[model samples]
Target chain A: MIEFIQALRDPDIAFLRYAMAAGLLAGIAFGIIGSFVVVKRISYLAGSIAHCVLGGIGAALYLQQVYGLTWADPILGALFAALSAALIIGVVSMYAREREDTVISALWVLGMAAGILLIAKTPGYTDPMSYLFGNILMISSADVWIILILDTVIIVISMLFYNRLQAVCFDEEFARLRGLNTRMLYLLLLGLTALTIVLLIRIVGIIMVVALLSLPAAIAGQFCGRLWQMMIAAAVISMLCIAAGLCLSYSLDLPGGATIVMVTGCIYLAGFSVKALRR
Target chain B: MMPQPVISFNNVCFAYDQTEILHNVSFNLFEHESVCIVGPNGGGKTTLIKLILGLHHPASGSIRVLGGMPHANSRRIGYMPQSTHFDPSFPISVLNIVLMGRLGRRPGSFYSRSDKAAALQALAQTGLVDLAARPFASLSGGQRQRVLIARALACEPELLLLDEPTAHVDPAMEQQVNDTLARLAHRLTVITVTHELGFVSRMVDRVLCVNRTVKLHPTSEITGEIIQEIYGSDLKMVRHDHQCSQQGHTHD
Candidate 1:
């Protein structure tokens, strides 16, 4: 613990501070968007979008290496991929011309396959593991700034649409009857979830993104009786998990993302058991 | 000659992909009238309600609501669904659920003071004002039904539509709901869709029997033959004192 604090202050290890800041800043969006994702029961949709981020990251890396496009940042690639996946999923699920689960599952697998193929074709020996399971310690100062901006955008937009989103999540038919363009609102929700997933990719990567996104909200759902309260509680729980996980990883020489997910999972299990026993 | 009907269906016909749900259905519901839409399951009772709410469009014919296109005046209509399909563990409060009735065409917004006031008033009308702060999932089956009704009322609509309001509710809760609707019937046009014949006879001025087609009869004119026609010969009718026999308007 003492070494971790010293590492936090060390100028040579500024990446530690950046990682910490990014995780905590990203936690706010994680909590808010995750609550909606969980309550709306669209975690499967979120999982697909998160996985598609890899296809973008791989494509961006390949573009930068092959075509010498310096501006094609992987994060930008992730944002593009996530948004595209969200729109396609939103439209397909809304129309439901085909079975929703079949389409989502197909997209989920296709995204991962596309990402792997793109990464394999890239010239340099890039480690997919680092992106597959995130390495938060690699986050740069620029990453922190991007996280901050995305975080602010998410919080503002969510707060602005709190009531409408609540209505959409609760009863879409009622919302439509009330003259709300429910389809548009549903698409907007997907768009926001895409952005949130992009932010989460850097913290826990694609595979474990759903865990971090859902666990805190699930834990909060056990105790809180309101969506806003659940969001606030989830955000706090997420930050605590990230902070503790980071310190534990630093001290114990463990992978940061996995450690954080483990901590969140443990807390959720504990909460679930307590609630069950009380009943 | 007459005040405009709150809802008018002109030779309306609706069909699912291959099956015809409602055929040549026509009706005129006036202002401040309580009408019950009754039929057996799959008899297009819900399809009729959906047509009025503009959730589904008819394959042919015209439907007018509040003197405009079906959905054009949707804001003036309040709707309570048969049952809300939601996650049982959802953390919304009763007040928030009711406040959703005030949702308008705005994209992203908060509930205003007037919206909250209107929601509270609707809750009071449903006799659930004290439970407004409680979690919606914590309410009983009857209370939940009333909360949904309150949500509909929260819109302060001129036309209120309820689908099976008494279904799944206990006798005591059904009584409370009946009383609430009885009071609401005096002010606005109430259209209820139900399978309960007793509810139809007691609460509505008229009954619209739907079974692939539409038939309107005054509550007193609902003979056993009419019931048989609507329900078909597959099911037997349980004649009660409230039932209409060969004798017209039997009081006992």
Candidate 2:
């Protein structure tokens, strides 16, 4: 514990500052969006979207290697894939309500397959493990800036549409009757979720992203009565988990993303047990 | 001669996946008229209401609400869907649920002070003002139904539509709900879809029995025979005297 605190003040360890900042920002964004995702019961949709990010990463790698495109940033490729997947899933679910789960499952597998194929076809050795399971220590200054901008956009949009979001999440059919354009709002929410998944990919990796997105909100939901309260509590809880996970990972030499998810999972189980005891 | 009906369905036909649900259905609902739509399950009762609310469009012919397209005048129509569809575990306050009705009136992005006042007024009308701050999940089934009704009332709509307001509710709570609707019927046009023939009151001036076809009858014309024919089964009708007796016995 003393060594961890000493490392925090060490000037030589600049990456720790970046990792901590990324964790905090990701926690805030995840908390706000995850509350809606959990309440709306679209965690499956979120999982599909997280896995779909790999397709973007693979495509960017392929494009950069074959065509020598310097601007083929994997993150941009990821953003494009995630957004497209979100739209496709949203439209399919809306129009084909009964077959939604089947379609989502198909898309989930297809996304991972496409990513693997594209990466294999690329004429270069790529370390797939880092992308599959996140390596927060690898987050660059440029990555931090993109994350900051995305977080700001998420915060602004969520604040502006707070009431509309609440209404839709509570009752979509009723929201439509009020002339709120529910379909459009639902698509916008899915889009935001996709972007949030992209932001979280660097911290938790694609496989574990959904855990980071959902666990804090689930814990918060158990204790909070209102949507906004759940969001705030989730944010605080997420930050604590991320900070703890980071410190533990550094001291124990464990993988950061998995460690964070484990911490979150433990906290969630603890919360459930406490509620059970009260009952 | 008569004020234009708040809702008019002219030769409307609707189908789902090639299976016709409502065929050539025509109806006219005037202002301040309370009507009940009763039918067996899958008898197009819900289909008719969806058309009126603009959630579903007629396959043939035209439907109008408030002298305009159904979608255009949607703000003037309040709707209460079946309570079974609601997720009780969702994190929301009763007041917040009611406040959703004011979304139509929001000119700017933010809700106005008047919107909050209107929500509270609606809650008070439903006798849920004291529980406004309560979590909606903690409410009983009847209370949840009333909260939904309050949500619709908050819209201050001229026409109100409720889909099975009394379904899954206890007999006493059903009476309370009917009384609330009866009171609202004095000023607003109330259209409800219900299977509980016993809950019908004098306030419901008309009854539309639907089964892929519609038969309009004055409330006085509704009888056990008609209900049996419409539902294709022997169904008993609770007489007004029986309801009075039940109420008195319960109180005693």
Residue A12 lDDT (model 2): 89
Most DockQ-accurate candidate: 1
Model 1 misplaced regions, further than 4 Å = B105-108, B234-248
- lDDT per residue as tens, model 2, B73-100: 8888889999989878898999999999
What's the DockQ of model 2?
0.73
Query: Which clashing pairs does model 2 show?
Result: none
Candidate 1 CAPRI classification by DockQ: medium
Quote the lDDT for B207 in model 1: 86
Q: How would you encode candidate 1's per-residue C-alpha lDDT over B80-127 as one tens digit per residue? A: 987646676899999999999989934448888888999999999999
Question: What TM-score does each prediction get for chain A alone?
Answer: 0.98, 0.98
lDDT (0 to 1) per candidate: 0.89, 0.88
TM-score of each: 0.95, 0.95
